[model samples]
Target: MSMAKDKELVLSHISLEVRKLIKMYAAVNECTQVEMLERIVLEWNAQQSRTERPPGDEDE
Candidate 1:
């Protein structure tokens, strides 16, 4: 399975403070900002997948 086919490009807006924070975190972690954002998003997705869903929500 190619994940490239499952992904979509997105544009987002964030406050300057948040942008600066991301940049600093990326620098400290020795990664580009884009990689840092992807890591955060992938971790969130993993967390969501591990969460239990409410009854009758299986179709989603």
Candidate 2:
């Protein structure tokens, strides 16, 4: 398989429960496991962004 030069592959050891959850979500939505994982990551990023403030962004 070929990947974009700007991208790099990552490896992680995930728990069995999380793996099963990803498979079930992918199957129900008819999407690939990778897509489900990406969705999960995006949601996590958004949640963190909302909770954290950037430098110099303190409340007035």
How many Å off is the CA of 32 in candidate 1? Answer: 0.5
What lDDT does each candidate get? 0.65, 0.68
lDDT per residue (tens digit) for residues 1-60 in model 1: 122332333214556787688789899999876677677778878788767667676654
Q: How accurate is candidate 1 locally (lDDT)?
A: 0.65
Best by TM-score: 2
Taking all chains together, each candidate's TM-score versus the true structure is 0.60, 0.65
Point out the worst 10-residue segment of candidate 2 by lDDT.
2-11
Instruction: For candidate 2, write residues 1-60 as lDDT tens digits.
Output: 222232213213556788789889999999866677777778888789877977888667
lDDT of candidate 2 at residue 46, scale 0 to 100: 76
Supply the TM-score for candidate 2: 0.65
Model 1: weakest 10-residue lDDT segment is 2-11
